[model samples]
Target: MSPSGKPPRAVDIVRRGLLTRPWRSAVEAVRPPWSPQESQFTQACTRCGRCVEACPGGILQRGDGGYPAADFRHGGCTFCYACAGACPEGLFLPRDGRAWDIVATVTAGCLALQAVECRRCQESCADGAIIFRPVAGGLWQPQLNRSACSGCGGCVAGCPVSAIKMEHSHGRSLAGM
Candidate 1:
């Protein structure tokens, strides 16, 4: 509702500062394995850097606000639970629960989508989450099986074009290309 007594439209929400802007400057950071929801994690975490030092894969780093986040540029998560064990606070869930709801997403920049043959992403995916399907007149297209993806980020750093990204699985759809 507005002071003018007119019903608010979707655009009004954005224009009137009731909703956040849609654009993002960077992708959301991935937290360490077994981390609680972002707000809870931030509230509970002490930025002690124990989880980052304990990471055998060396993927954990001090991200924004000095909180630890996963940087999959070097390797994928092994789900070793070392980060969870090293946390001095209750910022993480039990290791028996799923780590997080993240999954790998392939963007339009994939080589195969441009008709250039490439299978690096598929090869790097140990969980066999990435598959290639043949087209009548085009090269095989990469298809991500969201259910099979372990969200390890194995394919992210290995991609030649940097097309892969980790996205929350809530409303994300499987690869259509």
Candidate 2:
């Protein structure tokens, strides 16, 4: 039984996989910058790979279900908006505005938090969102300035511990271009 207290739908079964595998992530894919909302983008994208081709960073790749997704391990987004320009379906938002509401999240496994000396993530962030502030016991703790963040995934790749991930800011709007 599902949390809704009803029989799971066929889509749910497929989403949960062959029962041997763990349940799939609800956020199945990370679309290109300026992309429309998830459900809309999935329904409208032609899977043409135009946006993926236009991405110079090479971070955008064919993700789950063949949809475009960003892999920050390759590199962070430069916000060139070339992906938006290449899309024929207008699936992406206008480029005249901010790109998206995504931002970096550092988990407990972060090296610095674990008392390990590491500044790779801070050095990688061009926006200076990741700042190491001195704390008790002469330890420097990494602090995130959410306002200074552009959700560019710049900090994700440099984390040697892989403690960083991009998540929604849940702001007033996600109409970033």
Candidate 3:
């Protein structure tokens, strides 16, 4: 109820609920590139800062429990194998294997969906994963190519509306490759 004793509108109530709830579905702990399954990686990792220092992308940081984690806000991963090479423990898999199965996903807060023209996400995507398709009498709609996306998080930080996120692929386990 408002200070004036009026009930809040249904839209306002729904909006508040949505805003309060965690919006980042990919809130799971993000490990460094080429990391083994979470359980094994945690057990094998020695909490050393070598990998963090070796990462040229500046995305790797000390995460919870003093383990290395990737924070893509600074930049996208280049898959340079620096972190893996620097790690003293055998916590990472072979560099030839897929780095990770996570992929970029766009949420409803996109400006284009709200009738605003914006293409920052698509432009920042280096892999050409994000494509815009024109809509008749309306703004173009962005579509994500999950297959093409390297899950490097290139488009996340550049999004003007903060609509991009990295989510685990469907039918894939977050732990295993």
lDDT of 2 by residue, 40-152 (tens): 88899999999999999998998867788888878789999999889888888888777876888788899999999999989999999999999999999899999999888
In model 1, which residue pairs have backbone atoms overlapping below 3 Å? none
Least well predicted 10-residue stretch by lDDT in candidate 2: 168-177
Off by over 4 Å in 1: 1-27, 172-177
Q: TM-scores for all candidates? A: 0.81, 0.82, 0.80
Question: Largest lDDT belongs to which candidate?
Answer: 1
Q: What is the TM-score (0 to 1) of candidate 3? A: 0.80
- Evaluate model 2: give its lDDT: 0.82
For each candidate in turn, give its C-alpha RMSD to the true structure in angstroms. 9.2, 8.1, 6.3
Where does candidate 3 clash, by residue pair?
A: none
Predicted candidate 3 versus true structure: per-residue lDDT over 1-177, tens digit per residue = 999999976678677868755643325667887888788888989998899999998888888678888877777899998999998876688988789878888889999878799999899999999999988886798999999999888788788777887777763312111
